[model samples]
Target: MADKKWMPRWFYQLASPRWCYEITGKLLPLFVIAAILLLVTGTVWALAFAPADYQQGNSFRIIYIHVPSSILAQSCYMLMAVAGAIGLIWKMKVADMVAKCCAPIGASIAVLSLATGAIWGKPTWGSWWVWDARLTSMLILFFLYLGIIALNSAIESERTAAQSTAVLALVGLVNIPIIKYSVDWWNTLHQPATFKLTERPAMPAEMWVPLLVMVIGFYCFFAVAMMLRLRNEIIQRERRSSWVRDLIAG
Candidate 1:
């Protein structure tokens, strides 16, 4: 017999929907607990403990929500596009399912970012909206997410829908960089990124620490949401499978 090929155990497990479902079930509770703890702690720390900005004062507190939502929106879209690409290249149904679940969550997060930005903008700029480069690009990203969701739902064939949405997601990947660099590339009203990997934060630790907590909490929340949606997708698509049937019966 020919020698068996070597593959990572996770690679094999990822190819199995049942394994994905089971593992997500095991992980979901932990993520949920972590999200709740982190979000609550962060919210309290941001609102009550953190010092107000010298410039924006109490209004700056909205950063706790806006910054995290904006970061998560972009991150979620990246994950969705990457998952879609995996589905396209590998023909993995689980990857497609994950990509599908990402759209709605990402869309909602994008909206939250925009809404909070508007609220923050009113005090900072004396206006609710601006035709700034970053804002425009972020709006475009939101539309791209909606387009993917609409395309997926409009197609009749599941495989065709997956393929089409995957292509759309891959094409839309260009917008992410535009959104990130818009402020720097153009004379925009939006401020530069507050947190950069290479430099110290613009704000004091008292402000940035809670923001960091909120960011981590948001990621945990996304994981919890994504896994819940993926689990539901697995059950719905695998309704006829023996394991799923047994699970339902039990």
Candidate 2:
């Protein structure tokens, strides 16, 4: 129905494996365009225009990419877990595809955050990694990502694998809160937040603005990557179906 098409009835209607495939394919290119534009502009602004930190000097510039990627890494797992819950509860094919698509992207972001943190750390803290609560939590998150990817692959049947991994994804989400509040709850070497909504941003506008741009850019990039992967997943899963064959033929 027109109403369904206009609204999010795709949540149910596009559960048709083929419909999900076609629609996500259409969305991929547009997300890619937005992602590239935003990412480039954000990188230039952060790297070139941002002011040097009073303490860290230019080293603090890493925060622009590191914070955004770290935030995305945590948030994306929550998203994947939520999607997994929907897939398990409603048995939706597209929901499972979304969860599948999110795993690697989230993992990659987590790794980037860790690597960048370590690079920043060697200069600031004199070590690449520490067993501090926040750092350890990030390491666990990285493994959690690996676990999800492994589960999705180890299982044989698509439906079975989806269900199994969806459950695992949900389980890992329990750690999200723990990771977030650990710095607040404990005495850690990592600084508490420099940015908050209630308070003015911690840094000068000149520095924070580029960081904000990068955050938005990372989000757009995540969306683009997830959609591209989701489209491929839907297509591969639906490959033998009549609609997919017709779509490819056309």
Candidate 3:
């Protein structure tokens, strides 16, 4: 009784793949609505309403998309790694599915970051590509995401694939800190962080506020995507189960 009281209801429920699928289905619409509203509002506010930068001029506007995507990409990787660890430790199928779903999403966002950075760079750096430390580390991060996806796909056994990818994801954790501090640790074309936990924002309220909104909106968008993919993953993985069969029939 004491153990039961100490344990949370939601934690036990999370062990059920069907429960996760159903709950995610119920939550999906709300996430979609929030993501759409927030992203649209933030993008419009950033592009049209925010004041132009004194140095980079209009080119700095790309930061709205680039920064958010980059931040999300790194964060998503961390989430994937953590989920992978949980799956490996607990042998949780739902957690493995979550880790699997996060890879493609993180990779896509990393690509967006690189593309936008290039677009922002052509004007600022006079070149589309650079061998700078920050750029190189980010490129490596993108490859790491792709590598996990590729490794997972190449393996035939589901459990084996999950374990292998979990190991890889754990090994990749070392790169996150390097990516975060590359600008400071080494001389690079990339500028230092615009938003720092220890310091006030380098930009004015008008600029940073929209960026904040966009960042939050991007996170919401990631959640929406991850949940959608997770639901599909649960269906695929649990297709043989009675609940899934009933869900399909009904």
Q: Which structure among the candidates has the greatest TM-score?
A: 1
TM-score order of candidates, top first: 1, 3, 2
- How much lDDT does candidate 3 score? 0.93
1 or 2, which is superior by lDDT? 1
lDDT, candidates in the order shown: 0.94, 0.85, 0.93
Question: For model 3, how does the per-residue alpha-carbon lDDT over 19-90 read when each residue is reduced to its tens digit?
Answer: 899889899999899999999999999989999999999999999999999999999999999999988876
Error of 1 at 80 (Å): 0.5
TM-score of each model, paired residue for residue: 0.97, 0.92, 0.96
Model 2 lDDT-worst window of ten: 1-10
Ranking by lDDT: 1, 3, 2
Error of 2 at 188 (Å): 0.8
For candidate 2, write residues 1-250 as lDDT tens digits.
1244455765787567767666767887787887788889878988888778888998988898889998999989998998888888777888889998898999999999999999889889999988888888988999999998998889888889888888888888878887788899898878776567778887788888878878888998898888778878887888898877888899
Query: Model 1, poorest ten-residue lDDT window?
Result: 1-10
Candidate 3 vs. true structure, TM-score: 0.96
Q: Candidate 3: where are CA atoms >4 Å away?
A: 1-7
